[model samples]
Structures are given as structure tokens and as C-alpha cells.
Target: MLVLGIVLFALGLMFSIAWHELGHFLAARRFGVRVPEFMVGFGPTIFSRQRGETSFGIKAVPLGGYIRMIGMIPPAPGQRIGRSRRSGPFQGLIDDVRADSVKDFRPGDEDRQFWTRKPWQRIVVMFAGPFMNLILAAVLFLIVLVGFGIPTAQPVVQSVSKCVVPASQATTTTDCPPGAPPTPAAQAGFQAGDRIVSFDGRSYDSWEDMQLAIRASSGTVPVVVERPEPNGAARTLTLYPQLIETQLLDLDAARTSGEPRYVSGSFLGLSPIQPVTRQTPEQVAGYVGEMAQRAVTSILALPSKVPALFGAVFLGEQRDVNGPVSVVGVSVLGGEVLASNNAVASEIATMLQLLAAVNVSLFLLNLLPILPLDGGHILPALWEGAKKRIARLRGRPDPGPVDMAKLMPIAYGFAIVIMLYGGLVILADIVNPIKLNL
Candidate 1:
């Protein structure tokens, strides 16, 4: 099951990457740019087939993918194709970039260049890739939230404990330890499937509210539970719950693999009924919005988290599950989801949600206004458009497109920073994986 999950997840990520490239390929073609190669993954091509002008293929590495558009950067002034220029400290880098931009160039293809397109068209071409990822995320969220639904604990008794056990020592086993006293729920004849209607003669709505009422009580509390009878009638039992000073498990932390923490509180030893509830369209939209906001927050907090990630790996500190995860980490988590003892529906939902979150991350990360990223191209396009507008308003001659080659050095610097950070994250993921409970 773990192997199957990893394979499936890997395949899903490949498709997502391919889908992202397709957006760029189609949009570039739409704007008359010659896209020579549209490939998913980087490094040596594993399998490639030429269709019309473009060669489509997958590479060995599954980390990232791209669509190679012709003439992404404009040529240097008076610099001819296949001609060498005078070398400076950064001249080699500039010449290399320019050469690569027109590498697949053929005669009479000058008019089909990427830089020749309108600024708005260029922006659209660049933005389309990330936009595809966003669409996929929304679709996945819909399938999980509205189609399959989500489970939530309700204010109803699913099971009643036979005996009182320490919260830290509780397990699925029904064997009550020697000398363990019977719980208040068991002594009061509380059974499974009992709907907790009210506590102390007051009707309650949510399970959390009932939990608070139970914890606030000390001695005996008048609890009203509706139990279904064999004769198709419901009987209300007034159970005098002799509350005990027991340790209550922290429900929030119980969802993870960390040792459960216990707090001293009044106990009843009744478990809430968990039911799968379908969300409305509005609710699902809200969920998607919330996820988008969280993605933005995570992206913004990435710089702040670098020190902590380093500390966790080097200083032997606790790993933060909420910290960044690489492709390897995500694939491992996917395998864990399938290997877990959770229900089949739950596993499927979790995997789908994971894929959705990945897509969301891709969408948000690509929007950063740095070179090599889609947003980098977008910023230049917007700036060029603004300059053209301002020139026309002042009745000056057309300034033409902004020279994007000048930003290559800065782009290279940003690329190095990105690679370094990604390396650190990858190392952390391998050395100390963030093991999640769910």
C-alpha cells in the first residue's frame, strides 16, 4: 500500500507539472512564440517525440519542469547571432544567456520571438502556468470537501468506556487493567449510540460545548441521553454522572504522533460520534479561500523559518511539521497516509487534499517577483507596459520594450538563493522527516 501510494502520488505530481507546462506552451504558441521544447522534469531527456515544431519529453529528475520559449531575452545591441563578443567579468554570463535564447532559432523566425509580443500578451503567457495549478487545486478541494465530505466529532456517544484509565495509557484494547474502577458512564448504564441531548437539563449543540460543561462539573451532574428502544421509541435516561478527578487527553494533539498530553479535569469516559458531513458550495469556496490565505502566509513566513529549520536539523531540536517540505517529504507523507490504519475513504480524501495543497503551494510560490519564476517575467511586462503608457501620455517617441537582459545578473543571484534554500530543505527532509499523525 505504501509503495502504491508513493507511485500514485509521484504520477499525480508529474501530471500536475505537465499541466503547468501545457499552460505556458499553449499561451506562448497563442502569442506566436516558438516553443521548441515543452518538457516535464529537468536534466537528460528520457523519452522525447517531436510534434510539429516542439519536442515533448520527460527527464530523469522529477523536481521541476519548464517550456522552452524562443528568444525569452532580447539580443544585446550590435550582437549578431553565432558571433562572439568582448569578454568582461559578467559578459560571458550575458552572452551565454543570449545564445541560449536563440539556440533553436531558424531563418525567418525573428517575427515569432517571445520578446516581439505585446507586454499584456507576455504577462498572460507567463501567468498561465501558475493559473493552471490554481485551477487544479480548486478542483481537488471540491472533490474532497463537497463530493466525499469530511468527518467531524458530534455531540453523541459512539462508545462508553468499561473502566477508568489514565489518558496517557488509553488504547483501543477493551481489556480493563486489574484494580481499575468502572467509569461513571458505565456505572450509569450509558451505552453506545446514545445521543447526548442535554447536560444538567440544558440542551447543547456542539460537542465542544458539552465537553466544557462536563469539565466544569465536579460531583454528580444530571445528564440527559436519548437511547433508541427496540419498540421504535426513544427513551430519555437521567444519568447522574459521578464525575471523577481524572486526566483528560488534549484532543487537538491527539491527531498527531506525539505522546498525548493530559490535563486534570472532570471526566465521563464517553467518546463522541464521528460522522462524515458534506460541505455546501459556499463552505467549500470559503475553505479554498482559507487555504489560499494560509499558502500566502506560509510563503511570506518562509524567510523567518529558515533559521528554525537549520536549528532543528543541526541542534537536534524538534521538527516543525508546519515548516517547508520538499517533493521527497511530500511523497513520503503520501505513503504514510496509505499505510495508516485509517479508513479507505479517509486515506483517499487525505491524499487528494495533499495534492490540492501542493498545487496551492506551487501557485503561491510561482507568484513571487523574482527571476526564473513566472512572476519575474510578469513584473517586467507590467513595467514595460507602464513605461509605454507614460511615454505616450507625455507625447514622447515610443521607448520600445524594457531591456530585460540587464536583470539577468539579479535573476542568477535569486536562482542561487532559491537553490541553496531548496537544498537545505531537502537535507532536513531526509535527515529528520516531519512525521504527522494524520
Candidate 2:
């Protein structure tokens, strides 16, 4: 059953990718751009056909799909224009789309080529996939919002992360959240949703401090808290401390930076407060973005953030080399997420949003002022634009295109690095397949 669920989820994700590409195809065709071929895989065509002006087909691999717009990839000096591929709908149009960017490009035409379109239009074409993704995400969120509205939980502060709390609380905070800090011998006296402000005689700004104070209690001691009652009224509750184990980090391992180590012992009973349901898109986006940004920033800042980077050279953190997740990871996550949704619309919407985010990021990243990337190409264009005026003043011919070839090495290097990292991730997955935990 679990395996079936995983398969179902994977299929759903593939559909989403197909839909994202379709968005671009549909738009390009609508704009009269010539679309040559639209395919659902990367390698050579296993099944194909030319229908009307477009050729369509499915490939042996189901992992990815693409719509080949004539002139999408810059035609080398002499390639033909307005070409397309269209096959069949035997398995149904798993992927179909709006427009062909080549519609504007005719044989021996440059000014009307995609490259000739206003930069804004070019950007739009490049960005549309991701744009659709964001929209899809919003729609999914809407469904989730209207269906099973997120519920709110008691605002009791019981758990704190090891990074958030003082070393002393390390022993107890686990129970404060989902993990058990301690049971019978030191069961949590507080409830799951209890709001603990000041425990024992110590005033703590964090659960860490609170935990330390409690562990330090060592015996029955009175604790006070401001908690919300079942009727929505606020009240005070007092509890006594029970004996519990504590958490402590090893100085040597902690110094490694690469290997953060912590030791925790049982604590008096303590479970975390309940988590509330998400209520708004703003709330979801804010929280999600915050988490994503922080995670990204933390990884990037790890070297500076860790004092013993020099000593930790041999020890590496969770091989986050892929800078978090590779495409495989995203697809896996998406598969798991979209699989359970009975509603195809909601699933598609969610999947589209994910796709949008990916494409938008791709487009933006490509536009960065660097060589070999579209950004690199654009940078030269910018410089050439300015240089044209200077050349006109100096009565010199305009230096067109500014030799983009120079960036080839840089682009190749970047591509290799990405490929290597991706290979490593793929290897890891093959050696130890990741389970869909959802």
C-alpha cells in the first residue's frame, strides 16, 4: 500500500511537470510563436508524430517533459526556423500548451526572432512557467483553506530547539515538544498546551532557561503559569517539579561544527503544547518563506557561523552540497504531497505552484549578471547598448554581441559543478533510497 501510494504520488508529480511545460507551450502558440515539438521527456523520442504544425510525443523516461519552441534555444548561425513536432493523444494529451515563440520568427528572420522580442516579453516567456507555479500554489492553498481549515492550538510554550534553548534545558525540552523528555519517573506535570512563562523561581526568556531551572529544582517545587482555560478565559496554574534527566553537549564535538553532538537524559514529565492550524496565505507564505530563507541563509552562513570551520574541514554537515535539495528531492516531496489529494484540481493547482516557484527561480537565476547564463548574455547586450553610443561618437563600428564565447568556460564549469553535485545526490539516493514519509 505504501509503495502504491508512492507510485501514485510520483505519477501526480510527473503530471504537474507536464502541466507546467504545457503552460509555456500554450502561451507561445497563442502569441503565434512557432512551436516545433512538445515532448514529455528529455532523451531521444521513443514515440512521436507530426500533427498540424506541432509534433508531440512521449519518451521512454517519465521524469521530465519539454515543449520545443522553434528558436527557443538560439539557432546557431544556420538552423531553420518555425519547426515543430506533434505526435498523438493516444495516452491523452498528458501535456499540451498555448503558443509558439517561433510564430514571430520566419525563415531568415532575426528581428522577429524570440531574441528580438522586447526583453520584457522574453522575460515573460521565460518566467511564465514559474508564474503559473505560484498561481497553482495559491489555488491549492485556497482549497486547503476552504476545506479543512487549519485549527489553532493552545499557545503554551513547552518545547524549544537545542539551538534555541540553553544547554541546561537540552535534557527536558524534547518532551516539551513532540519527543518525550521524561515519563513516569519524571513525567511532565504540565499539559500539552500549557503556557509556561516562569517555572520554579527562575524568570526565563526561553524554554531552555525554564528547563534548566526545573532540572536544577531536583525535587518537588511549585511553578506558576498564565494559561488559557477551556472557556477561553485566562487563569493561573501551579505545578511542582519532578526529577528528570538533562541534556548537555560535548564540547569536543560541538567544536567540530560539522558534528554537533548533544546528550539528553530523562526529565520530569513535559510534553509540548499543541500546534495551531494555519489560517491564512499570508501566514503560510510568511512562515514558509521565513523557514526557507533561514534555512538557505544558515547553510550559506555556516562557515562564518561556525567558529571551528578550520578544524571541521574533515567533518562535513549533512552533505547539503546540493544546497538543500536537488530536482529529485523536490519531485519526491511533491509526489508525496500531491498523491493523497483526491481532487485532481487541487493536486494540479498545488503542483503548478511548485513548478512556478522552480521556474521563476530558474529564470531569475539565469538572469543574474554572470557569464554563460542568459544573464551573462544580457550583460553583454547592456554593455553593447552603451558602447554603441560611444562608438557612434568615436565614428567606430558598433561592437555587436560583445563575444559571448568568453563565458563558455565559466558556464561549463558551473554546469559541471551542478552536474557533479546532482550526481552525488543521485548516488546517495541509489545507495540509500529515501522513503516518502508523508
Candidate 3:
């Protein structure tokens, strides 16, 4: 089962890579850019087939993918293709990149080159890859939220606490401390599986409403619960339980600070059962929006986590559960999820959510505006367009497309950093994997 889960996740990852590259391929084709190859993964081609002018294929390494479009970098001003007189290390690197950019150049294919396209067209082609990932993430989130549902706390009682414990002294253990006061619900004979029908003489539709009512009330109150009988029948019972003031979470303050905040409220000591509940489209949209924001924040914090990642890999430090993970780590997590003794729907939903998160991460990471990223290409194109616009407004000669060849050295450097960081993450994943608490 573990191997099967890993294989399934690996296939999903490959499909996501292909989907991302497909966006670039389709957008490039739309703008008349000659894409000679559209392949998933990297390294030696494992399978390929020619379709029209494009050779679509899969490669040995399922790490990343790309679409090869002709003339990615414009030639140096007043210089012919494949010709460079500059003699320096950076110049040599730039020249090499320029040469590869036009390696597939053919007669009468000048207009089909990617650099010849308008700035907006070029931007569309480059941005399409990340946009596809965002779309996939949203769709997967919708499927999981609407189809499989999300775990929600219901009004049904899962357990009843024996004694009152203050919110500030919260602990995992349910054991009552010596001389602790007995909870109202326990005194009222509340049992697990009892569904709260009404509280304080008021019928509530949701757990939140019941909680608010409980907090607002004081002294002995009539609480109604529908308890199941031995004959599969349910009977309503009204029990007078004295509500006591205790510390409870302040949801509004917690939302602002992203940390627990507490205030005094009436305590009943009833723990709600969590059941899977389907959500509306609006709810799903809000959920995905929040997920995207968190993903962006995580990407921004990635650099700070590298030292800790190395510690986990080399110093035998504990791996942070919320820390960065590589593709290999995610696959292992999927395997653990599948091999666990969980319900089938729950496992499937968890896997889909994991894939959605991966897509969200891909969507944000590719938009970092660093060299070799989609945003890197996009920024230059926008600058070129702005320069042309400014030149026309000032009655000056139009500036040609930005010279991307000049940025090749920086791009190469960034690529190296990315590779090293990825390697470190992989090593950490292998040595000190973050296991699921389940």
C-alpha cells in the first residue's frame, strides 16, 4: 500500500508538471511562437512522438518540465545571430545563451520567433504556466471541499470532561487535577454521542450558536439533549446544569494575531464531534484564497528556513512540521497517509488537499521575479514595453526588446542557488522526515 501510494503521488506530480508546460506550449502556439518541443520531466527522453512541428515526450527524471520555444533571447543590438566580439567570462556565458536561444532558427521563421512577439504576447506565454497551476489548485480545492467535504465540529458530544480546566492551563491530558471542580455537563449526566438539541431553553442550529448561548448564560439552565436508547430510539432529556465562568477562546482576536486568545465564558465541558461537511462555492473560494496567501508567505520565508533545514539534515535536529519539504518528502507523506488505518474517503481527501497545496506552492514559487523564473521573463518584457511607450511619448527612437542575454549570468547564479537549496531540502527529507501525527 505504501509503494502504491508513492507511485500514485509520483504520477500526480508528473501530471502537474505536464499541465504547467502545456500552458506555456498552448500560449506560445497561440502567439505564433515556434515551440519545437513540449516535454514533461528532464534528462534523457523515455518516450516521444512528433505532432506537427512539436515533439511531445516524457523524460527519465520526473522532477521538472519545459517547452522549448525558438528565439527566447533577442540578439545584441546591431549584431547578427551567433556572432559576438566581446571577450570576457560573463560575455562568453551570455553569448552561449544567445546561441542556444536561436539554435532552431530556420529561414522564413523570423516572425515566428518568441522575441519578435509583442510584449503582452510574450508576457501571456510566460505567465500561462504559473496561471495553470493556480487554476489547478483552485479546482482541486473545490473538489475536496465540495465533494469529499471538510472536517467540522458538530453539536454532537464526542466526550464529556470530568472536571473544569481553565483555557490558560490547557493540556492534552483529560485527567482532572486533584480538588478540581466538576464540570456542569458531567454533573448533568452528559454522555458521548448525545446530540445537543437545545441549550438554555433556546434551540440552536449550529455549534457556534450553542457556544455563544452557553457563554452568555449563567447559573442553572435547562439544557436539552437527544440521547440514543438501547432500542435505536432517541429520547429528549432536559437537565439543569449550572453554567460556570471559565476561560474560552476569543475567535476574533485569534484571527487577527494567528494565535490563541482567551476570555472568560461559561463552561459546559462538552467536546463536539468532528464530522465531514460539504461547503458551498463561496466557502471554497474563501478557503483557497486563504491558502494562496499562506503559500505566498511561506515562499517568502523559505530563505530563513534553509539553516534550520541544514540542521535537521546534519546536526540530528528535530524536523519542523511546518518547515519546507521537497517532492520526495511529500511523496513519503502520501505513502504514510495511504498506509494508515483511516477511512477511504478521508485518505483520498487528504491526498487531494496535498496535491492542491503543491499546485499552490508551484503557482507562487514561479512568480518570484527572480532569474530563470516565469516572472523574471515577464518583468523584462514589461520593462521593454514601458521603454517603448516612454520613447514614443517623448518623440524619441523606440528602444528594442530588453537584452535578456545580459542577465544570463545572474540567472545561472540563481539557478545554482535554487539547485543547492533543493538538494538540502531533499537531504533533510531523507534523514529527518516529518511524520504525520496520526
- Model 3 per-residue lDDT tens digits across residues 224-307: 677775554445454444444355444333333455456566777888998899999899989988888777767766877887
Compare candidates 1 and 2 on TM-score and give the better one.
1
- Each prediction's TM-score versus the true structure: 0.79, 0.57, 0.83
> Candidate 1: where is the Cα deviation over 4 Å?
77-88, 157-272
Worst 10 residues of 2 by lDDT: 90-99
Q: Where is model 3 poorest over a 10-residue stretch in terms of lDDT?
A: 248-257
The count of residue-pair clashes in candidate 2 stands at 51
How badly does each model clash, as a count of residue pairs?
0, 51, 0
Top candidate on TM-score is: 3
Q: Where is model 2 more than 4 Å wrong at Cα?
A: 23-33, 47-52, 72-111, 145-153, 156-188, 192-269, 275-278, 291-399, 402-410, 435-438
lDDT (Cα atoms) of all candidates against the true structure? 0.84, 0.49, 0.86
* Model 1 C-alpha lDDT versus the unseen true structure: 0.84
Q: Between candidates 1 and 3, which one is better according to lDDT?
A: 3
Ranking by lDDT: 3, 1, 2
Q: How far is candidate 1 from the true structure (C-alpha RMSD, Å)?
A: 5.5
The TM-score of candidate 3 is 0.83
